[model samples]
Target chain A: MSIAFFAAFFLAWQYSIVWFDIPRYILTPPSVIVTKGWADIDRLLYYTWITGVEVVLGYAVAVILALPLGLAIAFSSILRRTIYPFVVCVEMVPKIAFAPLFISWLGFGLLPKVIIVFLVCFFPIVLNAILAFSSLSEELSRFSVSTGASVWRTFVKVRLPAALPQCFVGFKYAAINATVGAAIAEFIGSDQGLGFYIQIVTGNMRPDLAFAGIFFLTILGLALFGLVTLAERLLIPWHISVRHQSR
Target chain B: MNPLIELTGVQKVFGAGPGALHAFGPVDMKIEKGEFVSLLGPSGCGKSTLMLMIAGLLDATGGRIAIDGRTVVGPQTDIGIMFQDNTLVPWRTVRGNIELQLELRGLSTAAHRASVDELLASVHLEDFQRRYPHELSGGMQQRAAFCQALVHQPATMLLDEPLGKLDAMTREAIRTDLQALWIQRHPTVVFVTHSIEEAIQLSTHVAIITPRPGRVERIISVDLPYPRDFEVKSSPQFIGYVRQAQEIFRGYGVL
Candidate 1:
């Protein structure tokens, strides 16, 4: 049903542009974009690969740092007061504004793009982790105490599993932002990647190719978001959100 | 023989400075071995607070609690505590959740395999062992939690209104399930509940507590026969005990 709806919608979009006598630069139809994308499929896939690497590497770094830091903030008041405010201040700064600084410092290689992605994804994952780790049930906490569970055992068995669903909320958000972050970083300064490709084509009056750039970027974003959703279903099958969706 | 549990002038004050709330206590009581003692009180009367103190999960502001002659300064190891919410780990199946009890205590789940199965069977959850808590109904989830608490065969069970959220039918079934389990294994149980009749049904001794800064209002010796089913609830003697408790509540202007 969803596939058919999209197909019909695209057909209408294709004919409507022609009926309105829209020029190719002003409004390239989906068919033109697809044909142009197919003609440059090799370059498009190559750039997608580059942006994909940036998104994945940056997201991985963010998760590795943010999750534990968030847990620390939740576990100790001292860390929460001392470190969290600084993290919030960093997050408060417009991340795009840091793109030039990153490019200047690290150069326009993969590093800058990856750093931008990390900056974009880090806060959400950590904030959710903080919320997830601390929101334990009172009875469950008492249960841990009564059972003589060591701190490590309780964390592994109870705390980690309970936090997964909420943590995934952050993960999903980070995955989506990762693509946008990479794109924006590339836009500020880069010779490679889909963002640079789209910008160059748009400047050269090839709206069709720009649309093709957008097409691949959207695919990368969807792929990451969909992967996270799938993992969430697999990991926390008993979660209310997951169970409700399956029904 | 020394009592299995003893409390001496136990008090729990919420805060140190002025405007402190005295949640419960200055309570003193002794529970004999293998006795089912219910702490009965109205809602917000601190029955659950008092239970936490005995479990050694919450420290008393004043007084001492000893279990088997050992002072309870930290969390007691030989007890299974259940709360109103089932608290079954949502990530685990019913069987896995039950096994967590033994795993937490650093005991081998393989060694206690027989008892774990027996506990599951007693609760009629043998078939649903593979299912998660979310898939189970309210009664079934509570039953799974009950099994989880008992899998280790703890010497004491601290139950804080474990059936408060269930429907009337579900509550009755679980109450019976609890009675059967207690009869089979005689663990020293400290059950906290707000219902007068429920206390009478399960407890050997009903420790009625007054509201706010709850003190022991009266200790009613039920002396009721075991397998205290619905028939017992309607029995003349059972009716008399309920009336006696109601009359006492009247004295406190609570009824």
Candidate 2:
């Protein structure tokens, strides 16, 4: 069904410019975009690689940092009271505003883009993880205690696995945000990456090239999102959402 | 011998200051070792409150509760408990959930593999051992939960309406399974329920509680014989205990 939808949508996109007598420069056909992308495969590959790095690294750093922080905040009143407010305060500020500051401070390199991506991905991961960690069934809590489970044991054996399904909510959000974040960072200031390539192509009035950059960016975004979903399926196949997916 | 569980004027208040809510109260009871005691009352009459206090999961606002002559200072680790909701971890299969108890207690789940499978078999959940909790029927889930509670063989079992969520047929089936498990190994049980028949069918003694700001109105012994399954539930003696409970509940303005 998804394939059919894509095929129909792309077919319309491939022919609509000709049907409407639209100029080639204004709106490129899907075929033109694909042809141009394939002709400039090396350049597209290079820029896509750059963007992919920022997407993966930035998101990875956020996951590594935010997940533990979230779980910590949930587990400790001290962290919840002290750290969580600061997190909320940070979240309140528009994440895009950080792109300029990051680029200026860190310079126009991969570091700035990565930081922006990390910042974009951080809040949801942390907040959702906190919710996931804390949202336990009273029954499971009682059962864990009844088994004489220590705090650490309970967290590892009971709390962690139970929290994964919900934790994936944050992870998925972070994954989608990662691509946009990298794009924003690159947009604000960068000489390389697909985001920068699109800027260059659009400036040159080569909409086909710009469209190809977007196509690659979309693939990158979907791939990262799919990675998270795949992990969710693997880690928590018992979750109702995942269970329902198979059926 | 002293009772396995003792409550001396135990009461629970939810909060303090002007907002203090008297949940349940100043009721005392003693439960001997291996005795199946049910704290039976109408809904919202603090039946589960009593169970939590005994489990040491919830603190009493006043007085004291002790088990084996020691005051319950914190959540007791040496017991099994079941709630109305089947507490099976969604990520685990039936077998894994049962093994979780031993795993949490720093025991080897692999060593107890046979026992875990045996627990599944006892509940007739062996066929679905590999299935997740969400995949099972409500009765099957509760049965698995019952095994999860019983796996470690705790000396005292605090079961708060384990069969409450199931339909009548499923409840009856699991009730018998519970009896069979208990009969196999007579752990001291403190069951909380609103069902008088459920109380009488399983309990050796029933402690009737009055409505809100609940206190134990009286404690009556149900002298029915072993394996109080469906047949015993309909037995004249079982009906007699039911009437006795109803008689006490009647005085408290309950049907």
Candidate 3:
């Protein structure tokens, strides 16, 4: 159904082009996008890999740092109360504005892009981890304790497992945000990557090439989203999200 | 045996100041090995709280609670607990959830294999061992939870309304299974429930509790024979017992 809808829309859009000359770059036809994409395939792949690496590395770091930090915040009331408000404050501020600052600090290397991705991705992972941990049933907590489970045992065995579904939820959003943050950082400061390609092409008024760059970026985002969804299905098959996906 | 479990002048107070309250009795109780006792009370009577205290999940504000002569400074390894709600981790399969205790103990699979298989067979969950919690019905999940509670073979079983969430027909089915399982293991069971019929049907002795500061109102012995069926509910003795429990509740002005 979705494919059919898109096919019909493309046909209509192509037909309208004969009657009105849409700008060559901004609204490049599907045919031009395909041709340009194939022509620049090698360059596109190279830049895509670079951006993809930054996004993945940043996301991996965020998960590693956030899981333990979030667990600590969730486990200790004192830490949560003292630190969570600061986290919320940082989360509310627009992270895009910090792109230039990161560029200046880290220079034109991959460091700025990776840091930006981490900044954008960490909040959801941390917040969801805290929420999931906080929402664990007290009755179950007591049951674990009475079963002779030590504090550490109770956490890994009971509390952590219980929080997993929620953690995946945050992870899904974080993965997507990580890709976008990386692309934006590339746009702000970089001689390479898909984001820089699009910025330079659009500046040169070659919308078709710019649209092709965007097409790759969209594919990257979709691929990242697909990867997260696939992991969620494999790891948390019992979660309602997976059940809903099967439906 | 000198009481395997003892609670001396145990008091549990909740909150502080004007909102502060006492949930259960300054309980003084003793249970010998292998006794099946029920803590019966109306809703809000704190029967659940008492069970939790005995399970070492909660502390006694007033006096000492000891299990097998050891002070319960914290949660003990020799106790197993089942709550009214199915607390199984939904993401884990039945076998995974059942093996949780053994895993926490860091027991090797080779060592605990026979015990795991026995528990699965005893609970009739061998076929469904790989199934997730959501895949099972309400009754089935509760049965799985029961098996998980007993997988470690603790000396005492503290059940807080384990069957309270099931429908009538499912409740009846599980109650029968529970009785058979109880007879086989014979762990010193302390069950808390608000239902008079359920208490009479399962317990060897019923400890009726008062409303707030839930002290024991009475302890009625159920000397009925074993292998009793659901048909026994229609008997004159069963009716008389139920009525007596109701009267005990009324005497406390609870009903």
lDDT of each: 0.91, 0.90, 0.85
Best candidate (score: DockQ): 1
- The DockQ ranking, best first, is 1, 2, 3
User: How do the residues B1-255 of candidate 3 rate in per-residue lDDT, one tens digit apiece?
Assistant: 669889898888999789989787788888778888899998888898888778777887888888888878777667788887867888789988888767766656567778888888876788999999988998889889998888888889999999888899998888888888888889999998888988888888888888888998788888776655767877899888899999988888888
User: Looking at candidate 3, what is the lDDT of residue B154?
Assistant: 84
In what order do the candidates fall by TM-score, top score first? 1, 2, 3
List model 2 lDDT by residue over A149-245, tens digit each: 7889998898898899889999999998899999878888999999999999899999999999998999999999999999999998888899889
Compute the lDDT for candidate 1.
0.91
Q: Per-residue lDDT tens digits of candidate 1, residues A12-52?
A: 98999989999888879998898988999999999999999
Best candidate (score: TM-score): 1
Ranking by lDDT: 1, 2, 3
> CA shift at A199, candidate 3, in angstroms?
1.9
lDDT over C-alpha atoms for residue B70 of model 3: 89
- Candidate 2 achieves a global lDDT of 0.90
**TM-score of each model, paired residue for residue:** 0.97, 0.96, 0.92
Tens digits of per-residue lDDT for model 1, B144-212 = 999988888888899999999989999999999999999999999999998888999999999999988
- The superposed Cα distance between candidate 3 and the true structure at residue A246, in angstroms, equals 3.1
Question: Model 3 over residues A31-65: C-alpha lDDT tens digits?
Answer: 87789778988988899899888888899899999
lDDT of 1 at A219: 96
